[model samples]
Target: MTRALILFAHGARAATWAAPFERLRELTQARVPGVPVSLAFLELMEPRLPERVAELAAQGVTAVTVVPVFLGQGGHLLRDLPLIVEQLRLDHPGMAISVSGAVGEDPSVLAAMTDFCVAQL
Candidate 1:
């Protein structure tokens, strides 16, 4: 089964808000050439989670892992995301969809950020 990775982010009204996420997507896609990678936003952006997943499903992706590109376990991640995932589950019963912890909360990420913070001093 074909597998894909989706980097999920909270979109903003500003177009520039997506640039970072797009760059992240590109970086991840380069690292994992075997599995396709894409980005989807929670709101105020194109290709919302469902649409992106549906497109992937149409392209024959059997499994997908969603990694929230957020800093903390905010309402979007804790509340909104689960509801969206549940809908996706119901919408695509055959697909295996799973979610991982927020990127900002990851140990490695936090370490990097901490180093960056120290450097700024």
Candidate 2:
């Protein structure tokens, strides 16, 4: 089955805020190879999650895994994301869509972040 990974992030007004996320998409795409990896923002940005997923669904991507890049499971993650997912599911009846936990909460990711913080000490 065709699959895609969407790295979802909270968009900011400053263009520089997107630099790291773009680098992340590039790095992830290089590592996964073949499976398309893309970046989508929630707000204050272009190509929101729905638009990106629509493009993927149209491209015949049967399954999509969305990784939230947010650091905390706040209102946007706890409330808005689920509503968005539900709507997207209805919008793309055939495609399998799944949302993963916030990247900052992943054990490995948290450890890495801790390392970076420790290094600053």
Q: What's model 2's lDDT at 49? A: 98
- TM-score, model 1 to reference: 0.97
User: Which digits, one per residue and each the tens of the lDDT, describe model 2 over residues 1-121?
Assistant: 8999999999999999999999999999999999999999999997899999999998999999999999999999999999999999999999999999999899999999999999998
Cα RMSD to the true fold for all candidates: 0.7, 0.8
TM-score of each: 0.97, 0.97
lDDT (C-alpha, whole model) for all candidates: 0.96, 0.96
Q: Among all windows of ten consecutive residues in candidate 1, which has the lowest summed lDDT? A: 11-20
Q: Model 1, 1-121: lDDT tens per residue?
A: 8999999999999998888899999999999999999999999998899999999999999999999999999899999999999999999999999999999999999999999999999
Worst 10 residues of 2 by lDDT: 101-110
Give candidate 2 misplaced runs (Cα > 4 Å).
none
lDDT of 2 at 111: 95
Candidate 1 segments whose C-alpha is farther than 4 A from its true place: none
